[model samples]
Target: MTPPPAPAAAPDPAPGWLVPGALVLRLMLVAALAVALSGSVAAWLVTRASGQEAMRRMVSQQTDEVEVVARLLASKIEQSQKVLRTVAAGITPGMLESPSSLEWLLQQGLPAVQFFDTMQVARDNGELRLSLRAGQLEKAADLDPTERDALRRTLVDGKPLVSELITGRTGEARVMFTMPLHREDGTVMGVVAGALRLQSQSLLPPSMTLPARDDSQLIVFTRDGTILSHSDPTRVLGQVRDEVGLAPVYTRWQSQAQPVVGRGMTHVQSDHIVSMAGMPLPQWIVARVSQSQALLAPLRGAQREAWWLAVASMALCMLLAVALMGWMAQPLAQLTFKARQLLKTSTRQRPETEMHWPQAGGEVGDLVRVFQGLVQQGSLQQSRKDTVVGQFQAVLDSATVGIVITRHGMLEVVSHQACVMLGYTAQELQGRPSRTVYASDADYAQVGDRVRAEVAAHGAFDGDICFLRKDGTPVWARVQGRGVRPEEVHGGTVWILEDITAAREAQVQKSWGRMHDALTQLYNRAAFDERLGQLMTERSARQRAPALEEEGGEAQGDGVVLFLDLDHFTVVNDIAGHDAGDDVLRHVARLLVSHVRQIGWAARLGGDEFAVVLPGCALARGQAVAEQLRAAVRAWEPSYQGRSFTLGVSIGLVVLDASLQDVPSVLYAADMACYDAKRAGRNRVETRHARDVSVTSSGRMALGPV
Candidate 1:
């Protein structure tokens, strides 16, 4: 039988499916390694970024502390300079010549200053004139080298000088502030000086009461490295660089053009963050130092924890990779083949073919369903996109105001109303630069910047601006707009513009009419009433204010009111026609305006009646003004239709005082005075004293005590 032809040379057993087992294991292992490496790098980057942020915050805090200390010290030095100036101004040559008188003067004045513990006055010749310490008079003597040098510098510059740290003759750490005293001829006669005691708590501001952390320090030092003040009293007046063992910091500070901040070694060989600021007035440096290691201890611990977490995640990923490698072998191979086939089919725009996946369950079935859903959803989304776009276009076209959408200030879409308002078709406006719709290049640039800034700050902007039509005519528009995404500088915006030129003109005319008379163009009764009410309210508020009370609340002594009535105004109107009467009245109004234009406001109350409010004119001066008005009326010769005659006016004067409660009371008093002047002579002046008054239910003034 030939043993079945020796098994017919059985074909080599089909290569055991190598893609299933070997390919899956290799892919999972590579993915696991990539995840582990990425986690490690990400953790390190995050830790480093957090540490940098913490360092930046610590440095900023130290900078604020140094700036605060410097400002407080400069302000204290300025206060001392002011005190020295006041003392210098009062000290005459006679007082400086007599030691006893000088000592007495200082004893009285020195008690007022809380910062300075000692004060001394010295002659230009370097002889101490007087010394006041703790409110006691002390013996005067020759000036020391520090005091003599400060005095000589002050004399040379004719300005104050703050000295460096000085050990007084009594062995106390002090800084001297000196100002020169000048004679009547501007010659230097003497020097006035004040001392800031380094050890005194009052020398520092009350707000300087900190928690007193031991590791932190504040140091005030001169440019040469001598310390003026320190948190540790023992270090006060010592050389800061030597005391703190920070020679590098000192050397860096000496050459620094601006403020400095850094981490450096301190006197104890410990790392510290140092912040330094220079004072402009006193020419000193202020520094704040804090232990860097102590500040960053928490961050270091967090870094360690982060590394451990990364390691734990890597182990978890390795376990997951091992488990996933087992099940994913067969399914991954089948899915890879199917995915490539599906992608190739999708590119051909073929009708989606139903995938004949194996009747397996779990991840394989879900993967098949996901692919089918993607194909079906893409078709549905395409159908809905057309409908939504159509609806958006409909809404945009129907907008009432001129609506526009712009990307980077270039027009993208415009509404029908926008086309009509700008005298341009949508084809002409869309895709064009927005500057085309502005009145000028400057208006486009300025208005675009302003509107963008407003939208950025407040999310919306509403303003009236000038826009140009296609015909190059300017249109006033009320523009309302909002940013689509303000935080992104390149994000576009939407604008709604309403034409408001006619409305704006009408508003202006209405506003002008409210404050002026239609005939004379002078202020009307309503304007007069509003202005007088505001003045009275201000005066009453001032009278009630505590500050005004402390200042004695003196009355405006020169305030006055002048009221006048034309004596023969009605007779002229009866003799001449009303047109001639109008001419006469206009001429009289012009005369009154010219007279009070400089010193006061003039108003026409009614027919032939006028009033003047003099803000700073006495009642006696008001009488002079009244006489001038009467003389002007008497000198005027009007020829109306072959009739020539002169007219007279009766005048009344009332002084404005705190006793008057309201404008009505003052007006009533002036009217009664004018009636008296008319009854007395019909052309003379009369005066009325302000009195307590009552108002009847008819709104008529009834003069009497309340």
Candidate 2:
């Protein structure tokens, strides 16, 4: 019948390549990413700091430019104030009373002082009596209220005062420097003032020398945030706070006790630098407003270059990862192929010479060396296996005993003696079940169980067992064996079988001779002593017998010993020689055997003297057995050498019991009774019971029972 199909196995999971391949790739990528991220962050920090430094430098440079412009303007105002004071020292009340003389004095003095837009000498009522315009003398007019207040302050303090920025009649921003004119007696007289036009390019530094960018500006504003003049002409004269971007900066500058330098917003940048310095005169603030982005342009360029370099590094990492993957996989693939080929070659019966495989350096080279070692080891092992097998076979054949190796209860290898002993060729025994050599299933199972037990306890076995030869005759074999490993005898068991058939038969014959007589082939006297002693020992021990119980009650001892003496057996030896005497002894032995067969043990003590022991028998039964043996001997007729003679036996019987000390005592009692029977009549039988009063350790004769 076809076997049932096996259950389908679950599919194996897919080979796990992601971990090995992706691990290298991911490691490289992660390292590169970490480096890139760190580099980018570091570059950003460096660039940000550089940008701030650039801004600081720019602010410093711009502030210096604004300060230079303010100083120039302040110097011009101071020089005009000094010139007015000197002219005032010359002008007396007389010069003030004559407008013509005052005009002439102002024109001559103002012409000597540069940067004076207009020069005037005014009375205490703030009316300019005479003035110089563009270096020409003109009639003076009353000053406006703002100009009067500044002239009044100048007269009251008797010192020079710088006026707030004002618009000229021509729509230009200007500042006036005013001083009180004093009389020779130290009395305040009129005011001398000069106005400098700030809008005129000459009042400010040259545009080319300014550090401010196109998007930047330099402005001079009042403490109240009023615009005075700006580098950008369009923003000149406008309120500083009116420009929304500059409001906060203007407020901060106004509150500051010293020059303020910080970032602020402007039209160009929401956050730009505003550096403010307070001018000495008019308390005006000179501020340099610079765009932050414009100042950091160089830093940005450097940052862009850093980002491009990072991108290039990432591309290089990709190329290296690809190259490393191939470099790693190729050597392993070659090693795998070579290893497989080596395995295939190693399995063949006759392998070729050692393989020379491809090699690489480093760890791959070490692996190649290991593979070479393995191949060489395999070759050495093969050669060793061949030598070992040859040596094993030589050892097996040389052994005196037959050795057989069995696997799974089948003979795998058989020695020459084993084959010869079984009367079969080596091929016939190989692969055959070990049971095939057993005489019977019982013998096979019996030997197997015993051998297994021996092997389990000692790793070896030895015993005698019966086996069948090829001709179906049984042979006694002495077997010794051992297993290769515990509980794995089925894997391999080495057995040595020595045929002991002839030796066993000889042993049996030797044993038979030691206990039996050569003349009658009956048990000898020594055997009789042994048998009778054993029987008496059993009877004394009270061993019960079923037969004796069924027949009648057992005496204290239930064994019987009989002694028989041949009647007139000397007459045959005298007439027909010792050969005829041997014939008579043989006839008597057979007669005793026929009468007492299976009843008990019988043995010939010596020439013409014999004894029998009946176990579990009462005295009455032993007496009846002795009479039968006497009658059989009397009835026997022997004819030897054509001569006829009749022979009879004198018999004596004794019952074995507790009173008998041992076999020797029983024999003495029976021997004495036999002599009594011979004395009374040669062929008659006499009986003695074990409890007879005369029987004792010291005496042999017993007349009657107790």
Candidate 3:
């Protein structure tokens, strides 16, 4: 009846077996999780290490490249200096002493070196007596006195000296290097100087290639903190100090003999480290490398792989979940395949998918609902990207100023305003070489050469260039160009051209107005002084050219300068209003212009003072012109507001000879002649022949005053 005691209560159903099985499943899950986590962590560590190594390699390579460039630049500069010294040493002491011989020497020496823009020889007395053949003898007065003194000191000290960047006659930055000229007896004779344009061809190589990175910048500076060359020389030249946040790095590099690398404290968001190398000329070549997100190409690929792996693991988990439900696996597999197909299709074409659930499904329906939400989000993101691109295009098209885009030297896009400014339809400019439509042949060639050179030297170029319009007239444009590979560009370089002709013209006119007199529209005293220096140079040069015999048996190589002053002009202004005085001035200026137009240049020196520059004119012709000017002024009648007035001119003429060396002496002689004319009597003409010689004025001759 016990019935085996109910099988002894089934031995408590072996609770130990159930517990051990559960524990075994839990341990497998934990082991798998630990293996996955460890794999992920190890992969992350490897990726981090690889990234660091790659960066280090890149930095080292960039540093080496920078050093090579610095050495090349230093070698070029040194070679140029040596060539100039050789030329200077060849000149004899007699050649250095004589203006004509020195000019001859320069004419022969300058063209030998391609980099020299102007070669000059001057005495210790600050007289620029000679210039090279390619030189324009204009505005010798532009030379700074301090610079001249420095050159003179170098010559006296028997040494070479390089000057800081200075502006030349053409308003371009140039570096002047001077060498001393010595006699056989070791006496200082003169100084030979060569002016090199920083933009000259030999300073840079024909081409340069940048690494596959965008956020890196390169800068070159002289030992004295002078930016000798740069990718954008115009922007960086003469802009001293670390104002652009590169100063601390530059200072540290210049102060230290070894290379220094550190993060820029001023710009923290940018993980920028500066590496600098030095050249023989005391220049510190610097390269700044920033840890840009775009440079993380390997990391980006790893992240994409990680994401896909996660997606695959999630899909497998979902499949396992469905299998546990005891439903027909085929239908669920079909549903999953359909969802995957829809996702793939949406990714390939457009992010819009219509997903439906099978009728025999509970889990299938839930899976479809989740996938549908993902599709909706993908569609929303696509729409946002499309909208942003469209808005950007619209803004660019509707901009106010003319915008032109060029790729690989060919025009790609032209805004409406750009089309109008260039006098071309957009279609006409499309696919055509930018030079074909806008730049002249010579200018285009120059620009093309410059572009190539810049790409080789600095990897980019940005500045103003004069572009010819469709009408064949030149228009100033701010042209900015950067080198790009196929990935950066649609496949070519990105060049931007902006019409800045109006602004440039305005600036030119403003500068002209500042340098000219308002009343007479003539050069003011400052301009006059400048011209006087140039005229003196011409006078000296003319005295050296082959002499020509005139029909009257006279040599006519000498130049005469006449400085004239109006007699009793203040009295006329007191009697008649300034308006009438202006009329009188106008009449006098007309007379002077008409009388001296053929043989001389006339400028209104100031109120009641005028200067007449008679080139290649002898003392007799100068005196005759002065007499005619006096007669014309005396006979002239100025009418203003129904009133008439008359004025007379007193002329003081100074004839410069081969002996005259300084401008001040000629000016003093003319001023002395003017004083003599005034003291003798008003309305008379006087001439001073030489520095100490005085002239007798014609007696007070009167034509009735109005």
lDDT winner between candidates 1 and 3: 1
Runs of candidate 2 with Cα error greater than 4 angstroms are 1-26, 92-94, 113-115, 123-129, 135-142, 168-172, 183-187, 201-213, 252-269, 294-302, 317-706
Over 541-563, each residue of candidate 2 has an lDDT whose tens digit, in order, gives 45455566557563434767888
lDDT of each: 0.74, 0.72, 0.65
Q: In model 3, which regions exceed 4 Å deviation? A: 1-22, 123-128, 137-140, 168-170, 184-188, 204-214, 223-228, 232-234, 238-248, 251-270, 282-291, 297-299, 306-706
Q: Among all windows of ten consecutive residues in candidate 1, which has the lowest summed lDDT? A: 260-269
lDDT of 1 at 426: 88
lDDT over C-alpha atoms for residue 628 of model 1: 87
TM-scores of all candidate predictions against the true structure: 0.42, 0.39, 0.37
- Candidates, ranked, TM-score: 1, 2, 3
Q: In model 3, what is the error at residue 121, expressed in angstroms?
A: 1.9
Q: How many pairs of residues in model 3 come into backbone collision?
A: 2
Give the alpha carbon lDDT tens digit for every residue of 95-166 in model 1.
888987777667654444334676778787867777766666666553457866886787677777888777
